[model samples]
Target: MSGVWVWVEQHDGQAASVSWEAVGLARTLADGLGEPVTALVFGMNAAALAQEAIQRGADNALVCEDETLAAFRLEPYASLLSGLAQERQPDVILAGATTRGSDIMGAAAVDLKAGLIAGAVGAELSDGRIVATVPVYSGKLMSKVTIPEGSPQMLTIRNRAFAALEPDAGRSGEVETVAPVLPEDEIMSKVVGFEAAEGEISLTDAAIIVSGGRGVGGPEGFEPLQELCDVLGAALGASRAAVDAGWISYEHQVGQTGKTVSPDLYIACGISGAVQHQAGMRTSKVIVAINKDPEAPIFKLAHYGVVDDLFKVVPALTQAFRERLGK
Candidate 1:
């Protein structure tokens, strides 16, 4: 059956959490479009990872296992996927918006001339057509785009945009072995040794994020923010100003140049929402902004707002939450 084809992402030979989340979203889109879900896994030994995809609601798992595919490089991975997509010709193609993933989507779209959508918040099927919602204007506005006269609509979903589903071992799905049509001689880029970035929490996958901005004053002001995040079990993110001020690292910066986070809860502390910062976090499920200025742009989009000093407010809120939870 022609269906929604999703790429199951794995990093460093292990299945990544974002892949599971993508499966959940694929299930939703497939159901809405009245199509089965077919997943693609490519690696040195992605067979084991393919089995995990079945439990995550895939109707069939396509495996392309080869030793040459051990590491992720541009040429081989892209050629293999582009060939599979051409022959399979599914109605919709969905991939995660990660380092390797984005690269694949851009290349595949070029090869197939298919419509590509990035950072999709949600997708819907209406009048026998697929329409998707993506953030625009640095997350200041949301646009629902429709891909017209396309063979297969390609969409790259951001991480943490949807909740993961429970795995049911009782339910088993089909698995198919695929051979790469493209030969190794045609591949251009070669794989080299890899290094993993060090971090306490990956901002993209954080459920709750506590973000600070220029209003925090300086590096010393982050102490309260950090304490509050620890109390709430949340990740700490920062705006460009805070990072530029040497209050935090660029990795913690939330903006166009940094990571995009759509956490369940995003608490903006002492921040005056700049367009750049909003670009990263406007997709959050619920936004709570705390700043001394009531007119801050963040308050306009925030579901809850507190116009007060973050130093005083953060500690009080933390205490209240701990007390309420009987911690």
Candidate 2:
């Protein structure tokens, strides 16, 4: 049990992509520490996910299955993880920097008195200690931190910051079912229903993103952007200004206040990049900017840029991609 552990987040009986990514990183860390990688899964019928975890590089899967654990409630989940950590004394725990992951991990860390690193993009073992690199100052700086000696290190990594390992169906590992230690009354919160979002790929999982800004004019302006996104199989993103202007939901916003995305390609249309917006997407592998203003700040960070009206440029680009991709 004194090894690396990943908290696998699942929804609708499927594991989150970030869970697999964390497994990949945990495998690397476990290899360096000469320890086994264990994945902790919680949900009803979570046995399948435990086996999936093994195929994704985990040596062991610790599953907690119960009707009460079907939906994610903070207290029960956090208490369960804390109890396990106290009993098993894991060397390191990794979780995705998602809303639920951040909440549960912080509570568990407080209970275990462990060092927690949030929004970590990279990690390594140095001098028998786990060191994590986290972004600071709107992604302008990276601060490296190490947990105190003899304490379990807890880290929440950003989505898309690490790649997931390919699953090998032939791989096998141990799966152990564990019961929750929390009392019935201790589980205070209850989930009554679920609501699904409209059709759109999550920005974190998207390989390509098409984003718009104030220059998009209004909510209607997103139409052309959506068309372009559809053609390229990309997600639609919005600058903070656009979101604040009520042109789009905050979920699609990308900035310091929004989600961080490191897609393979990012297309900024009519956006005069602010530092906050760039901080969220500056890590993208490739960036293309289209703006009528040649002095737009976004152009400085773009690998390719075109100074023109987006209304004309975007449609043309969409048509061209559609013709070439035949989609």
Candidate 3:
């Protein structure tokens, strides 16, 4: 009831950008509610991340850097977070809707018996409670959920839904070190190996994304899209059809069954933009569709449409962008 809290997620000592985005949202909500923002850091380099959290927006930070907390193991991390929330009694808790973020939040919410609003696009203070705006029915409709008072309101924010504040180097805040709630022996799960995709920007964190679908043909079809992605310094994405066709890996799929993305610009090439696909990228700031069929469903939601063969248009666009960018 005293402060607003943000969960700072990190990997290999580097904090995820979405974590800072959550901190930014927490700062705004905290200011409005007249409560301080406290960032919770539970991993390697927690102290440094705690300071960066303050630079981003938090008023203070609570850090726990035990060996067991070094890598993200669910049981220990969630137990620590839940215990802290129960003891401190924060008004609200916010986290990025990444896989790890969502997992930890859901587990902690179960422990605390608190209401959790997942993948919220917008939030505001209403009558001393938090009202979260969430997309429902495959992004076809939006519903608002208001968290009641008494327990800490929890929300997982969608990526790119809100803007992050500029960091101020001079900004300073208190960093409190805390003990891990669970012992290493009591933690059930273990992280055996971590293999991250090399050289590809994560779709969720990409500012711009270029996606391919059924029109792209086979695995070789993704080469053109890769060229465009390289030219634009954007992430490469695919629809479920393309993924199922082996045109691209499942990691690149963007749809209801794939990763949700809200980039500044989303370019759909050879994609029909089915409702399932729209569910993921519908919240993008700008959308462009290119397909031979003018009647493609993707054109319905696109801000700009190109009725031409992707083979002819994609290469032309890539070359134009390369020359324009001098790359």
Predictions in order: lDDT: 0.83, 0.91, 0.91
Model 3 scores worst on lDDT over the 10 consecutive residues at 144-153
Residue-wise C-alpha lDDT for candidate 1, range 1-327, written one tens digit per residue: 268888888876677677787888888878887889988999866887787888888888899887667777667777777788788788888888888889888888888888899877777777646688887776768899888776688888878766567887876888899886556677776766666675467788888899999988888888888877777788899999999999888989998777878899999998898888888888788999999998999998899999998888999988988898666
Clashes of 3: 1
TM-score of 3: 0.98
lDDT of 3 by residue, 1-327 (tens): 689999999999998888988999998899898999999999889999999999999999999999999899889989999999999898889999988899999999999999999999899888778889998876778999887766789999988887788889999999999999898789888898988899899999999999999999988988998999999999999999999987678999898898888899999999998899998898888999999999899998999999999999999999999999999
Q: Which should have the higher TM-score, number 1 or number 2?
A: 2
TM-score of 1: 0.88
Task: Tell me the deviation in Å of residue 49 in model 2.
Answer: 0.4
* Candidate 2 weakest ten by summed lDDT: 181-190
How close is every model to the real structure, measured as TM-score? 0.88, 0.97, 0.98
lDDT of 2 at 261: 90
Instruction: Give the Å shift of residue 41 in candidate 3.
Output: 0.6
Would you list the clashing residue pairs of candidate 2?
Answer: none
> In each prediction, how many residue pairs overlap at the backbone (N, C-alpha, C within less than 3 A)?
0, 0, 1
Two-way lDDT contest, 1 vs 3, winner: 3
Candidate 3, superposed: residue stretches over 4 Å from native? none
